[model samples]
Every structure is written in structure tokens, then in C-alpha cells.
Target: MKKIVIVLVLIGLSVISAISLLKTGEVRPTRVSELKSQFLEKATARVDHSKFPILQIKAASPRDLTAACLSCHNKTAQEVMQSNHWNWERPEYIAGRGIVYLGKKNVLNNFCIGVDGNEGTCARCHIGFGMRSARTFSYTDSTNIDCLVCHDNTETYAKAPEKGGAPEPVLDLNYIAGRVGSPKRSNCGVCHFYGGGGNNVKHGDLEEALFEPTRDIDIHMAVDGVNLSCIDCHTTERHVISGKMYSLSSMNRNRSHCESCHGEAPHADNILNKHMLKVACQTCHIPIYAKAHATKTHWDWSTAGRLRDGKPYEINDADGNHIYLSTKGSFQWGKNLKPDYIWFNGTAGHYLLGDVIADTSRPILLNTLNGSYHDPDAKIVPVKTHNARQPYDPAHRMLIKAKLYAEEKGQGALWVDFDWHKAAEKGMQALGLPFSGEIAFIRTQMHWRINHMVSGKDQAVACTECHTRADGRLANLTDFYLPGRDRNLLVETAGISLLWISLAGVLLHGSIRIAASRRNSKRG
Candidate 1:
């Protein structure tokens, strides 16, 4: 009888616990796990080029190897020929300037200016061989495609400096051609990481350190982390890569987004995921850039021509970084720095060569990053603002292009003769633009979107970092109201008044209840 009574009590207790759980809501939504990276599942080994008898022949030149690749991938070579890497030209529409052909061939940058007269040196980054001059370059040449440069598995091939994109003479063409495969990080880094003449010169986030990085530096590229390759994110179809730099491309198309891999709603909390509406993934994830090396933050071309003795000289800081040079100018380098916040909707406009500058008093925004807090499509993104004191045509109100590279001495190249007027005239004449003759130094700024050197969630920015009134990352964004940072005088007074009224009402209700309870007790 005692055992029966104990069992009945336990059943009653279980029923009460179940009822309590149901009332409190027992079901919870589970966050799905992130899918594996698609590139990680791809086959690594395919098409042994060494087995092909055509690749065994001793190649006399880089073009001979291209012919062998064409024998199998004739269709692939055609696709490559159409790519921007080969032609260095893309038809794009700008905001004010409509339907302009913007590319490295004609687009102007603060560093090195443009590639019109400097094709011999600048064409080293081009995929095809023999692009000595834009006017003289034959885009129809099929054999000009340097197949071994991108496909070289032996890592023995490289484009020689100032050789019109030809492979280095020291490379064993036959050996590299036999072992051809898809491009690795080193192949892309060879030109990209070292662009603007040295390591970490152009893009701050991309550098030599990305070859093999730790998890702290870049969670995506880290060997111990996901160990992702450039091709993984770049995701090429035929030869057209998906990602395009706004520095060259002006369109909103063909961009790589973080959502490509991680879903739009990756966070567990709804509050955190809602931030994806206005805040870009990079804004919160990439707190700093140039993780391992210092990037050039400033360049003063006004101080470039100063020479030591009769010869051009270079100066390095205690950290062995170029601080000043007779050819380039004075530079300011920064390492692991925070990026400037900006509202970007992907569309951008550039001050193309020969385009007149609107204002002379303020710094010329060489490329204007257009967006506002009101735009629904726009999101806050982090960018590296590269500032420079570049040469300008004050009379024409335009940024001037100077002849930077010279094949021989006394060719009016600024690097060789140190004559700004002669270089400007020569460069302008080559591009079919009139030179103003009056050259003046003017401050200019260019924005490079920071996408790489990403950090994981643990290293991501905290809420207080951008929520505080002072030293906030998004403090410069004053157009919209940010909670915890922004406070209005009217709202503060209304909130305080409401709080005092609620407190007085609570006290009055308590006193009335106590008085009623006392009256009831006296009547009893």
C-alpha cells in the first residue's frame, strides 16, 4: 500500500513538471550548421600534362608552350583571350560619364599614374606576352597567351621585369610546360602582392604573409584554418574571374560577396543577424588590415625628384621600409590599421584621365565612393583611404599623367630625366590628350575596399566598440541615428518624465492596497 502511494505521488509530480514546461515554451529553433566550402570538395588532380607527348618537346619561347596548351584547350584559350587579363579593357558605365571603356590600359591611379607610356613595365602583370604599347598591341594573337605562367606547377616560370610580359629566360619552358596545372596563390601573388613596386604597396590586406598565414592573421587563408586558395574564392568559369576591383571596374556586377559561402543569416541571434541589413560582413569581421606588413598610407610626389649627389637614391626606415625615394616620393607606412568606414552600394565613379577636377581648394576624391545612410541597398563597409600629393594641371583643373617608365635615358620619362613638364607632355601626347604645361601639386585620395585578412567571430568587433559616443568605429556616420551613441535632448526629458510618473503611480497604488487591507481586517 505504501509503494502504491509513493508511485502515485511520483506520477503527480511528473504531470505537474510537464505542464510547467509546456507553459514556459519547450520548443527552440535550431541554427543549421554552415555547409562545407564547395571548393574544398573539388578534385585536386586532373589531366596529367606530363603524359601528353606535345609538352615534352623543348620549347624555344613562352608562346611555343601556349601552342601545346591550345592543342587540347583551344576553346579555353579563346575564353582567356576575351578576358580583361588579356585585353586590359572593359566597357563600363560611370555615374556622370556614361559608357566609358575603363581598364588598366587607360584608368589613372595615384601611384604610377597610368599605363599609357609605361606598358613595357606595367604589362608585366598582363596575362599575354608582348603588350609593349596599347596602340600597337594585337588582341587577336592566340599564341601570345602565357599558359605556363598561370598553369606552371613546377613554379619555375615568371614574367621578367619590363619585358613586355615575357617569361624569364632562366625558366625551363619544357619542364614547366610538362607539369602545368591550375594557378596557386604564388602565381597570383607574384604580380598582385608586389604591385606598385614593392611588397604591401598597393592593397594593404594582401601581402607576402598570406602565402602561409596563421589563424589570427586571416581565418580564411590560414593553413591551420580553412586553408582556402585564391581560386577558391575567385571561382573562375572558363577564364573570367568573378571579383573585380572598383579601382578599375566601375560596375556593380561580377562582385564576390561573403554571402557566397556563409548564408545571409549565419548568426544564431536575430538581433545580430539583423545588422546584416545595414552593416557589411567586412565592417564587423575585418577590424584591421595589413596583418603582417606595413602598407603605404601616404605618398608625396612633390618630394620625389630630390636626388642624393648625382645619382637617384632610396631611403628606408629602421624597420627596412621605404620612407623616401628619388623615383617614387616620400611614403608613410602603416601596419595592422583600422579601416575608414563608408557607405557603399558597389557602384563607383573614377576621375578618368583628362577629366577636369571640380574643386581645387579641397582634396580631389580621385574616385568617389557614392552612397548615403538613406540608401537601402547600401551598407557600411571598411576601406583603406590612400592619400597622395600628386601632380595636377591647375589651369585645366585636371589630374596630370606623367611618363613614368623609360626604355632609354633622355626619353622625357620623369623617373629618368626628373623633368615634370617634359614627362607630362610626352605622356599626354601618347594618350592623345593636351598638356596644360602648368603643373602643380595637389592632394588626392583613393579608396581601396578592404576584404581580406578576415578574422573569425571571436576576434570580431564588440558592440561597445561602435556603440559608444567616443572613439566609436562608426562615429563618423552622423547622418543616421545609432543607439547608445546618439541621444536627443527632447527624448531624454520625455523618458525621465515617464519614469517619474510610473514611480508615483506605483507608490499610490501600494498605499491604497494597504489602506483597503487594514479596513477589511478591522471589519473582520
Candidate 2:
């Protein structure tokens, strides 16, 4: 009876130990479950914007809706007015140029030249109202703010390009006002995706397709994936959005990088994690850009004004891309394009207005990525190289802003008359600058940093792509020496010669040792 009791006690202890071990080893929830829980927590905490009194009434204009919004959120207008989106200007210090004000308002681009004389059309992208012209526009007016542009969740709010930043009259302001909430991908895509007057023209990475992306399109923004919105990464504070483009920014502005969400070390491999020091996350993640549509890679304004049968004509390439448009110019479109690699530390050297040109013969670099292999903060980043041949003043040595559109008939617009001289003269007059009267086309290049269109891990660039070839993605990069791809003939010859000599010495020594051993054995 004592042995039986002892055995039973031992078994009971074993059972208790096993149960404790099992409890300790059991995984409560997986990563998927944790993500689901987090999503549920957020879903339960959502607020209904319809309950607000300001959004209850019907409004005529976007400004009126904004006035209603300001009644409650009075500081919101002041916060937005201070943002780059409203001001269209940001002060920054350049390398050669000292502290200067730069933005779309001042910076000259190949597309639409500059916003100096075209504020009305360009103001469609602006966050303000009644920006018909630079002279008449008031930046201090808080009532000019458009709150529905970023906050509307109804998806019905839209600003007409020709309406001087006003919302369409047909839209139900009350319905849209009631549905105002967090900004969606579609909200941001309205202007950004259609920049340069068309879809996928300005920023190659951003497109309308991102509104409802699939897992294969973009892993982060995909509906089937994390389904992250633009605001998730572009975390805004005081109505100022983060992530300024290098071309637009001069100073080292605050930006939301991959490290903001993904830690410094996100890879499983230590080797790959170490690579993050010199390799940008987008360099490998976005293997190709313009996945959804073919983006314009080249534009030649010199080729414009070509007419067939006294009417403007257009030519299409083999891939059905617009090669020539009578109104704009010849274009080169590309899809699934490999990015041009560059060393970047977030700083960009922009060609500000009145800046001296380095080379007049070759394509002038509008903006160049600022970094080197020696820079510890620099990394190899991918960029979209947009080439263009646009109008420039030969005498003033500055890019010319041609007046392309006008509300009236005799406004000296280039599209109206097909005369470059008149358009240049009118544009310069509007800007209050003297025209040299000498019009010439010069090749120019702009490097657009690629940051979106993230692919799956399996679609990343292979190791051999850059390691084995001289003309690889990193071919232009000469900051560091690659082993297999870059080799010195003298060093290779010396290494080969030393290897041969060492092999010969070893063979002779082994042969002599073998013969001596056989001789010793025979003597024994």
C-alpha cells in the first residue's frame, strides 16, 4: 500500500509537470491574430463624421464648407496655410546657392515649365482656392482653404483643372462634408498621379491603380495585404505631410523613410541587414517602376507644332504609346523600366532660377542626387531618369516658361498661335522678366526618386544581377570597387602568376619527398 501510494504521487507530480510545460510552450496568438486584433481595436474606435453639426448643412462652394469647418477647428486653417501645399514655397539652403525660397511656385520643370503664369491650372493640385494667377492669389486668407480635398471619404469630391481650385458644382457638398474623414490613397492620387497633365506622367511610381491595388501590384497598399493608406507612411503633423521629393526640396527636410516603419534591420540575414548601410530599401524592393501604366521617359518640346493636313497630329509607337503629340511634343514611354542607380543621402542639387549652367551642349541636369560612396549616410537608390528637350533662352541662359493656355483668344498662348516667340514673350512679360527674344531648345534631365510600387521578396533583384556584370544596374556607380565585376588587369596577372609559382613549387617538393621516401625504403 505504501509503494502504491508513492507511485501514484510520482505519477501525479509528472502529470503536473507535463501540464506546466505544455502551458509554457503553448503560443497564445500568431502574428496574423495580433494584426487582426489591432485592426479590430481600430475599427471599434472609429468616429462617425456625420454626427458633426458643421457637416449637416448643404454648402455651395468648397470655401463655404471650409468656413463651416473652421467654426469648430479654427486652428486647422492656420496649420494648412503654413504647409508647403498651400504656400507652394519652402526655404532651403543649396550647396552653391545660399538660402533661397524654392518649390513648384519657383522651380522650373520640363513639364509645364513653371507655375508662375499657370497658377490657375496648376492650382487644381494646390490645397487652396482662387489661385487663378500668382498676382491675384492671397496666401493669408484662411477661408481659401479646401478641407474636403484631403478629408472627404465619399470619393465624390473632385477639383476641375480649369476651375481655379474650385470643386465641381454637381457634387453634393452636404453628403461629402458629412463623410469627411482620414485621407485615402484615392484622395492623394487625384493630383499627384495626374501631375504633368496626365496619368502616370510626373511621378512614375504613383498611379490611379494604387487606389485599389492587388498584392501583386503593391504589397503594402494592396487590398489583400496590409492595405495601408498613404497617410500611414506619410504621417502628417500640423497639416504638413512628410516625404518631400528631392527635386523639390533643397534643405535636409524631415522625411518619412522606410526606417520609420521598418527598423534599421528588417532582414533575416545579417549580410542583407548590413547591406542596408549602403543600399536603399527601395533599390531592391522596387525592381521596376510604372508597373500599372507606361510612364513618359522622354519629352522633346522641339518636336511640337508638327501638323498633318493643316491639323495637329499624333503618332503612336509599336507599343501604342504616344510618340508624338502636336500640342505638346514627342514623347518616349516605357513600362516596367529598370531604375537608374545613384548615391543619395536625401539631399538634391536643384537648378534653381537664375543659377548658372554647367554645360550647355549636353542635357542640363535639373536636379542631381547628392551623395558619394565615401558618404557614410549615402546609399545606392533607384531613380527615374526623365529626359527632355525643352525651350530655353539662349541669351538669358534660363529655361523659358511658354504660355500654353489662356482663357481668352488673343492671350499669346503657344497652343493658340503655334508661335514660340510670342508664347515666350507673353510668359516672360507675365512673370515680369525680360525676354531675350532668342529661343532655343536644350536637352535637360530630371532624376525622380523612386519610392513606391514595392514588390514581393521573391521579385527582388537577384544577387548576380549587380555582382557579375559590369553594365549592371549599378554600372554608373564608381564610388566603390566590386570584386567580380570590376577588376584590374595588373592585379589579376600578379595574382595568377603567384598562384602558378606556388603550385609549381608544391609539385616539385612533393615529387622530391616521394622519391626520397622510396629510396629510404629500398636502403632499409
Candidate 3:
């Protein structure tokens, strides 16, 4: 009984030791308050804009308020004028196309076509004033700048979409100007959140939910986590934003990267740390995009003009996202979408304006992410692959510019009359480019880089997600070989044959040893 008690005690002690070992190995989650204290402890602003006498006056127009601001900040407007935000033009040398000037004004996107003819509707996101109806607006005019759009702390200032990017008449300019301060999530989100047409349209990662995101939604922007603002990562120099658009910009000029804040070696594990050389920070950090809202993934222009009683028709998906629209055509939106992985360096190869179509049968690549495994600068990154079927001219062997939104109904507006030929002709005429007079729908795809709405480290994709699956996320990437995921027939057969032979040899040796032991026992 005493011996039994001793054995029982030993077993109990072993179980306790095992439990303690597990407890020690487990990592505890950081508290919200602790994380906030660590990352969001910023110094209070020194200069209050409300105290200034210039902001006290009742401003009649947005330009008037800008002029008042210029009285104190003399070079602010000039500095803004030099930025791509104001001019909407950035010149870059693309592969196969040399030194092409690209921007929102020049690039033909799947969404809303182009901004050439629809400046009034599209310029709502522009930072300047008097962009309505004028094909050539004055960029040098200092008064045309809208400072309240970025500086308004009151959140009362908002640009009217129909009013040519002007501040709403109901807005108290004096109150907004008095409360003028540095831009916040709300200030930037007013335009960016509602890009394309509505919320989560153009950029899959950017949405209104990022205004006050939770830790699970976006670790950096989380109210409980780092709570980083847009300006924190997109560090501006002389009013020019640092970040680069994959399709718009040729190279990352400002160099906003994960290493900017987090050092080169962020992960504690050696294996994960080594992945940083070939894998982008966002690839692992942001497992999925459009967490809060559904993002448009597909747009088919061929299905437009499905009307009832000579009027536009509309249809909605189960989640209430617009699946079909008479004005915009068909759309497919999804939430919590897995990103398309690609090898990308800083540079992008774009199909510039007037560039000839390479393959008429296959989907035209509007802009391709230029990179490979061999390229030292390249890394495997996550991107939102947006597919579309848009109008193209077979005769010209180029994409057709369709006038989507026009003031008059019969003036070659696809939205108004559902006439592709008239719209194509009008759009081509406006741009002074010759149209083939034959409009055909062609498949096209655009790769939009996913940089925002980052999830917590714990939510990152597991190794088995890609390393084990045959049709994994990285399966399409043929540039490099991945172990366990990729295989050669000879190597696989050799490995299997070696494993079987070793097992058979061990069994045979064990049988012989057992027979020898029996024989020795008989002799004894």
C-alpha cells in the first residue's frame, strides 16, 4: 500500500510538471489598454488652429477660406499645386511604352471608364474647385484649393458631389475653419472610403469600417491597438503623399513599407523571418481584404441596357450589393475575400493610352505587376484581381473610350440611350483619337495592390494553407519551387522507394534477431 501511494504521488507530480510546461510555452494575448499605451501614446498638439484670428472670420466660399488660410500659410497652395493630387498627372516610363504620362485623368479603369468626359461627377474626389464642365481647369489658382477638406476637425465640412467638388452650402465655413487642424481618419475617409461610386468599390482594402476599426479588422488602425492614422504610414513631404498606386505610379517614390516602422526582422521565428526576403509583409499580415464591406470584383459592360418600360433596371445580390445596374452594367461583390498572390517589385508595366492590343482573344491586362523570383527587388505580394468585360475597338486594336455619363440623353451617353457606337464615337472624338466605328466587348483584368485592413498576427495564414495544397495560393507562381507543395516525378518516386526499402530492411533485421534469441533459448 505504501509503494502504491508512492507510485500514485509520482504520477500526479509528472502530470503537474507537464501542465506547468504547457502553461509556460503558451503566449498570453496583450490587453487592449496595454497595447494602446505602448503604440498610441502620442504627444498632444502644440498649436491650436481655433485660436488664430484668420480662422475667426465667416468665409463665404471654400476659396475664400483658402485665401484666408494663405494669409498665414503663404506657400501651402504652391506646394499643393506641385503634387499629383492637384494636377492628376504623373509621368513615368513603362515597359514597351516609353515615358507615358499616367494618372486618374489618363488611366482607363474598369470602374466608371475614364475621368475625361465625366469630370463633374468624378472630380468630387479632387482637391481643387471649378472642375465642373471645364475640360482644362486652372491648376495654378491658389484660391481653387480646398484646405477645409483635409484640415476640418469639426467634421461638418463635406464636398457636394453635384456642386463641382465645392463645400456644401449648409456647412458652417467659419466654424470649420476655426476648428481646422491636421487630417484625421474621418477627413481622409470622406473621399477615399467612397471611391469608384459607393463604399468599398475601387480599393478592396479601404472601407468606412477603417474609421474606427477593431484590432481584428486592422491591427494598425485599430482603436485598441496601434491606432495609426493614414498620415502615419503615408508620411508626406511638402504636401505630396508618399504611397504609390500599383497601376498609376511607375515606382514607389515615397517608399512606405512595413520595415519603415517594424524593423527588417519582425517575426520571432527564424523560418518566418527568412520568408521576409521573398514574401511581402502584406502577404502574411493581411490574409483577406474587404473584411467589413463587400468589394466589387467583377464588372461586365456587355450586360448593360437590360431595361423595363424604356427605363433603367437594377438587381441586388443576397447581401444587397448591386449585381446588375442599367447605368453601370453588371457587378460582382464579395466580402472577406482571399487575395491573389503575385510577384511584384516597386515598378508596374501599364497598358498606356493608344497602346496596341497584344492578344485580342485573351483578357487584356490593363496593368501588370512586374516582378519575378529571380529579381532581387521582387517579392511575393497580395493583390486584388479585378476582372471586367469592357468596350474595345477591333479595327484600332485598342480599348474604346466609352462616354458613360453625359448631360444630354441622346448625346452618345451609354447610361442614357444604351448606344455603344454613339458613346464610343463621342468618347473617341472628345479625345481626338480615331475610332474604328466598330465597338466590341473584350475581357480585361486589373491588379490592385492590397495594403490596408491588416489583420492581427495571430490571424495570419497557416503554413499548410499553401505548403500542402495542390491548388494553393502560391501554386500559380511558377517562378520558384516550393517543397511539400511542388514535386518532381523522379524525386517523389525515389523518396517513396527509399522509405519502403528502409522499412522492409528494419522488419527483416528484427525477425532475424527474434529467431536467434529463440535458438539461444533452446540451446540453454
User: lDDT per residue, candidate 1, 207-258, as tens digits?
Assistant: 9998888999898788886678888888899888889888888888888888
User: What lDDT does each candidate get?
Assistant: 0.86, 0.83, 0.84
Expressed as tens digits, the lDDT of each residue in 1-524 for candidate 3 is: 99999999999999999998997798854354454565576646777777887778777778888999999999888899888888888778776767877888888878777888878677877888878744588887899998888878888888887666787788888887877777889989988888789899989999899999998789999888778888888888789887877767876567688887676776767799899999998998889999999999999988887788988999998888899998888999989999999998888877766778988999988888889999999999999999999988899988888787766677888888788788889888888888989988999999999999887668988787779748887888987888768888898899999999999999999999999999999999
> Candidate 3: worst 10 consecutive residues by lDDT?
28-37
* TM-score for candidate 2: 0.87
Which residue pairs does candidate 2 place in steric collision?
A: none
The window of 10 residues in a row where model 1 has the poorest summed lDDT is 30-39
TM-score versus the correct structure, for each prediction: 0.89, 0.87, 0.88
Candidate order (lDDT): 1, 3, 2
| Model 1 lDDT, full chain set | 0.86
What is the Cα-based lDDT of residue 122 in candidate 3? 79
- Return the lDDT, model 2, position 119: 72
lDDT of 2 by residue, 1-524 (tens): 99999999999999999998997787665444554455433332176767887788777667888899899888887899888888888888888877888888888877767887777678888887788886678989898988888888879899876778888878888888877778888899998888887888887899888889897778778888778889878989888798888778866667878887677887756788888999999999999999988899999999887678878888988867778888788898888999999999878878866665667898898887799999987899999999999988888887788888776657887766677888889987877676789999999999899999998679988777788756788888977986557888898899999999999999999999999999999999
